[model samples]
Target: MTTTALGIREYKRGLTDLGNGAYAWLQPDGGWGWSNAGLVVDGDESLLVDTLFDKYLTAEMLGAMQRAEPAAAEIGWLVNTHSNGDHCNGNELVTGAEIVASKACAEEMAHESPAMMAKLMAHAPEMGEVGEFFLHCFGNFAFEGIEQRPPTRTFEGAFDIRVGDKDVHLQQVGPAHTAGDVLAWVPSERLVYTGDILFIEGHPILWAGPVQNWIDACDYIEGLDPALVVPGHGPITDLRGVRAVRDYLVYIRDEARKRYDAGMPVLEAARDISLADYDSWGDAERIAVNTSVLYKEFAGDHGPNDTQALFAMMAQLHKERRG
Candidate 1:
């Protein structure tokens, strides 16, 4: 295990046994497409939480889990925390496991397919700076030819299922990180696997939010009083990490609101906002997307975000920061 400057202990890449048959799959320098996943096991039954950005990564994770725990040889259920490609793109590899997700996540996944990603990567060379930024973020992952296997089971609000004698609770706490983000809670183990809800030391990109919903989601996770919190990215943390994320959201929301009231443009506000407090976080350029979403929310625009335009803004901001 390696510790960050902030004193957070980060585990090595692969399965970390969390005792009681709970394991976390961590990818170092958890930024962009490098995401984390979890495995919960009881007796001969096991439930897998999320997947990696591609089949190879997911296959590696599965292999590690199966080697560590015999129950993981055949996952009884695969729970996708959200619809992000990093979390659900490898769903096809789980085989016969009953893939489960939030109703909103399932719908979102239908549109954000691996084929779409492959197409984007194929055209990245022609897109100039935006494409460069895209390649920088996702180039390492293979998107071509991966089948999109959506959820076979979906629910709204909350759902409950069992893995052996332990009960795992699924709570839909989004329209925050994504349209339908879910938190998988193993009540008996006092453990919670938060999708992208908690980015730990990284800046979270708000693809869907009113900001308040994300804050409330953070509160809900805190309310659970979990002993072990496995975040979607970065190291395992407790309520402190959750509050840090919430604080960042609140800071950005208020800062963006002031700029909005002064009639500043979204891109300008994103660039102007002081990130001194969060300077240590990875992917600070995500402020471009977060600020843009907050500006739209302030304007009472509930429309879908112009993704390509956002990526362009992020590319510009990323370049500026690098310089």
Candidate 2:
């Protein structure tokens, strides 16, 4: 089945042609490891936006794209929006393509290998509730034995490139969702593929944030005046969706700051923040991480996130919510 929004047709899964030889590979109920990817084709060349969480998922997506459009068979360029494993872990499958990403994204990818995920999953059973929550979030995908393929080309700020006759612009608007986030724009098509910068119909996790950077990133997307916005997760959206994400960031930042001023702990602040406005969005537990990051930003802390502790908080929240 397909749903239409502001003239953009969204599919439950698989590729949806966006006219002008552009297409989006959407995964339904976009959450956790489930991400969306894109293809921009012109003549004999095609540029892929991002890949899925694992080889099997990426292979399926590639197969569908190749069957629908021959140019996908020889993807000339693969642009990873960020360092997140879900976006770049499938790089090894797009053979012969010149992989591209932000310089920070490449560096971040080097430190986060699929092996680390595999090891985490391996020990999940021994970790009790955290393990259960981790499995609930990521257990569906395979993480074992996937080779890491670093970007062959890295850039900072903004870079413009071509896919056949079409001009594709890459803008790095990050240290928001991740250390490096990118937006792929096809000017002629008036379409923008916003990596994790926009998460429609879900609470976005702020893994890296000043919060302002992410809010500005939303403004950057709006400034483009995109006719179609393909988010890193969830359905394809328009300017309305972009604004929604920006508003969420602003609201969370302000609310979290209020609690931080009261000297509330990170997890406590996270749990205390009311998500009544976003009750319809999925993965509400991510408020755990979002608040944690915001609290750090408020304190001027530049330290690395305590991943396990964050997960434990999320697990506790998730369990409490379920009960």
Candidate 3:
């Protein structure tokens, strides 16, 4: 199969050097917390786009990077694109680096501490449906030793900074995937590390959404026309990939809207929606959460999500799919 400069289609896990001081760390079958990260190097400085789910995973990525580029051993700037554990749980591993994130993301990070995951993992085996769903979604990572080091610096909108001599643009485009989602755009190299904004081959879970915001995020990516787009999950893609994601969101939103207007329950709508077109996408069970969020948004509800309930519903969807 043909591959893009930083594609992860062939590798389950590893780093791909995109040339000219940019690299992408891929974790394939990008399901659950299995996400991807990026590294930008210039002169003697290195900027880490995001970290992995746990310390060991982050260490392995860093070690691979260090071997490929000696300067990677000391990351000067660490950017957390969002508040997801897969992207920031390894922040503590970067010790002295100046960590940065959007103001909203930093706040979200605090609420989803590593201890939260530890607690969930600890009780997962005993909790029935919620536990089954939770473990099914997040059981792969080691959450015990994560120290939960959040970003030291925060920004509200677009910000520009340097990784050595390369200019990295941090653009906040969230309240979509999360409260704060940023895109790390290396304009000079024509590459963008789109933090959960683009999930290439997987169904993106809408933990937070207006749905339109997520669609707009894709438009923003296409507007940039980056040569390589490294998503928070899945392989690297170009403008076409961005369009696919946008199209999926648009399709689901329209489908869910019709059901919402008819007063269908969220779970029923999720189950009723045909995913035959997206059947090949990983994590098809996420349709449950996506439909639920879309339903809530359609009803003008902006309340906090009932995460456990959502997971239980997803668990049900998964079982149905399996059977």
Candidate 4:
């Protein structure tokens, strides 16, 4: 039992049983709250996907999973879909779980940890509104006690693991949202847990890729036609969910290309593109970052990704939002 601002009550993790001992967890409510994790469990063994932000929230997520399956006693595997802290932090809460993620994701995971985020935020909480939102959004969520345990195994392209009777497939589906993004496909359940590949209701941010890579990723996912698609953020969806993201990417790509041709500035292009389908997503202001990456892809921005530059572009977008 935990005490929330609302009141004290037993922690309830997220959406319950889908089938075949599979369950989905909707993290919490702020923004990182938008991120989700999953459980593939059987009687005695299980696998988990993408732990939440802090130790407390991750513990809550695990506690809920145990309630749903009780197999946390012996979770066979833990697969991280990407390098984002929201997806992989708080891993210390799960005892004896063999962690797994893409090689790229693993490498990136090492670059940042819960402790690191805590430290950075402690010093410059206002580095950017995104960082502030991260702090504010996750402020109530407990990460204070969590240990950062990254994956034990790393695969390059594809890998498969069996938990009791179910098979979990991990596919390296990145250079789209990040350098290395992976998706977990439970063959028997017809479900694909897309880390950041499918944001469902949220705007898709491109951190690493040629834009087309992510577009192709959406196409591959569409071709699979999975019955249940669990996004890194947002509720559970399906093939239609995947197509919606593909459409958004295609539209943005075309829109960005036109701006590139028309010689509009990156920030201007981000504001002008008009992402109608994704206006409902949180952080729609991220369009500037997307435009920056895509603009560089086409017109060539030779400078390395400056942290300052990224935030400036987003700050401009956030500023634009106020007007």
In order of appearance, the predictions have TM-scores of 0.97, 0.97, 0.96, 0.89
The list of candidate 2 runs beyond 4 A from truth reads 1-7
Report the lDDT of model 2 for residue 320.
92
Model 1 lDDT-worst window of ten = 1-10
lDDT of 2: 0.92
- Please state the error at residue 186 of candidate 1 in Å: 0.9
Report lDDT (Cα) of residue 179, candidate 3: 92
lDDT of 1: 0.92
* Cα lDDT of model 4 by residue, 133-174, tens digit: 445444655545457788899999899998887788888878
Q: Is candidate 1 or candidate 3 better by lDDT?
A: 1
lDDT of 2 by residue, 53-138 (tens): 99999999999999989999999999999999999899999999999999989988888989999999999989999999989999
Quality of model 3 by C-alpha lDDT: 0.89
Residue-pair clashes per prediction, in order, are: 0, 0, 0, 2
Residues 207-320, candidate 3: write the lDDT tens digits: 899889899989988888887889999987878889999999999999999999998888889999999998889989899989998988988998999987888888888888
Candidate 1, residue 70: how far the Cα is off, in Å: 1.0
| Model 4 alpha-carbon drift over 4 Å, by segment | 1-13, 28-33, 125-146, 300-304
Question: Which sequence of candidate numbers ranks them by lDDT, best first?
Answer: 2, 1, 3, 4
| Per-prediction CA RMSD (Å) | 2.6, 1.9, 1.8, 5.4
